[model samples]
Target: MECPVCGEHLGDAGQVLEGLDRRYAPCHACSQARLDPRAPPPEAGQPCACGRRPLDQVMAAVHAVLADGGGLAPGAPLAAVGTPLLHPFPPLRSPPFLPPSSLILLTRYATPSLARRLLAEVPEVRGVVADRGIVPGVGGATHDLLAGCDVYAEARFTPAGPLVLYKQVSTCHIEAPRPRDPKVEATDRAVRRVLPDVFVDACAGVGTLGLAAALRLVPAVVLNDAWGPAAWFAGLNLHANREALLAGEVDLLASYADLRDVPAPAAPEPVAAARADQEILVYRGSLWDLPPLLPVAGLRLAALDPFEKDPDRLRRIARRWQDRAGGEVFIP
Candidate 1:
């Protein structure tokens, strides 16, 4: 696919997938591992530069790249460089997983474009996302995407079909795939215990959680996000992963206006997109406002991964959803 903004068919998905699918062994076994990618060191088979490579070697390579651009201090420690994030693909272990591979380096030293070019010195590196940090206007548990794109596919491993998800990088929140990604595992357990007819990812971020439900072949799913980019990306992901979802014609029924464009909605803003039956209704607004917009359901389970971290607030969010929707609520 091409860049929606620049029409640049940038970032090699083939290469990205090869490296991304190279899941590392869990932490204990990762200490002395090596990940290999399909692409060569720079362009096309390379011994990936992550997973058990000598720290000095990794750091030295990164240092040289920054030095080429003339930014590395004489002897700056690693922390001064940046953080490395591995592919957000399924089966990918959770945070604190060591020696990341098929990764994107989040930095502050250069523009996203520059960082992308410089970080090419490392074979396993896919892109460079700048650390936008927690400031107003940002959303979710991630930082920001600077350069390149992010892509992932699940090969019919879970209750869902094989699927594909990609992002312009910056438009979606930062999330890595784990053996038990939020809402994914919860959805799995819920399915095993007793399958439900409908599932809702109230705070769907790019449709991960809700889509997990869709993968389980849930008869219907409602994915809503208060953020426009997220809501938009969620729709894109649903389409991209449709084959896995057994989804049909995606229809845009309604859309979101500017937040201040009108009076507070007593219901959801609008239906961004819908595919009835095995429907993935992408809505852009608060879940409280989303209830009246949801399609009918017999059995329902709603999963949420909220941005805010307050414990009390979380309890209220769950309680409120259960009261309003009268379904099983899960936060994972």
Candidate 2:
């Protein structure tokens, strides 16, 4: 197999190590770099020259295992098999490189050995396991697999422009095994219709909605999330898009504030625009503490997406934003 990181032939450069739930193959260069007494430790999560990570290589091995197991069959329709509601990560979405019709196996608790053996013997299958369950807004062991390398980046194309998001796998859930979901498309359209000068994503999981708004050139966007991982990735994503942001492609002032603590009427740090129109800020604290931190008077739009069955919380948030800025609020 080819090393996803360096594109070196793994069969010739190194050995493939099968772990408890994943497999890894480090090319000789990387392996030696790790063992070399005089060299610095290889950076975690850094992509190789081929723009692939160790995780990507592991997934490739998993794909091979599935193909060898008779899990991949010709003419079979694409299907998702595993816990209902659990989806594969974004990178695996509509993997055009795979067969036209493919199968995805989503498991919450499958041993690595079993996963490999089953996928190799089973026909037409590629799978990923999130042992802690893929529940959004919940953080726990589900992300342990990504300990050393928790960030995942995916590029998405939108009508406004192309966007890249960096997400921490531990906090937010991966939605839709496919590249695009009708609901997300609908939400994007709705947001575009009332694109506000000052947009707030109250529950900005990886800042997807806010990022879309930013791409549309929303003058000011404030992304808030109570989860640390989500907030951390939101900041990283903002930085990843800094070039475009600074270029004024979409006149935007993006800010990420973690609403995990602090009291009500909290003050969010103001970010000075580099140009007359572009600025960025990142904060960490609680939702109730955001009133003082936001431009309540100028706020024009807000999106409140809470967990299913939490309509009351969503309504409360809507009411707050409505009372503060009278901005249009969207709920789902």
lDDT of 1 by residue, 1-332 (tens): 34443354423323334544444433343334222322112211223334444333354456557655766553555456665555544453332332434455666765655677655556556667666664312533344555554433332244444444554344455554444454566677876565777778898866777776787788878898776656765676676566555567665443323431233345565444556457668877777877776667578888877888788899999999888888688777
Model 1 / residue 103 / CA error / Å: 5.3
Clashing residue pairs in candidate 1 are 39-44, 40-44, 40-45, 160-215, 268-289, 275-279
- Report lDDT per candidate: 0.58, 0.46
lDDT of 2: 0.46
- Pick out the ten consecutive residues of candidate 2 with the lowest summed lDDT: 12-21
Candidate 1 runs further than 4 Å off: 5-59, 68-70, 86-103, 111-126, 135-163, 168-171, 252-277
TM-score list, all predictions: 0.69, 0.56
In the range 1-332, model 2's lDDT, one tens digit per residue, is 22122233322101111120121223334312222222222222333443223332233333344334455332222221223221112333221222211234454434556565644543223333444555645542243331122233455555565556654344456654335645346557766787566777767766677666666766777777666556555655665565556423322233223222222224443222223364444444455565566654554777777665577876877898678656688874
**Candidate 1 minimal-lDDT segment of 10 residues:** 37-46
Clashes of 1: 6
Model 2 clash tally? 20
Off by over 4 Å in 2: 1-95, 98-130, 134-136, 139-141, 146-150, 177-192, 247-276, 296-299, 309-313
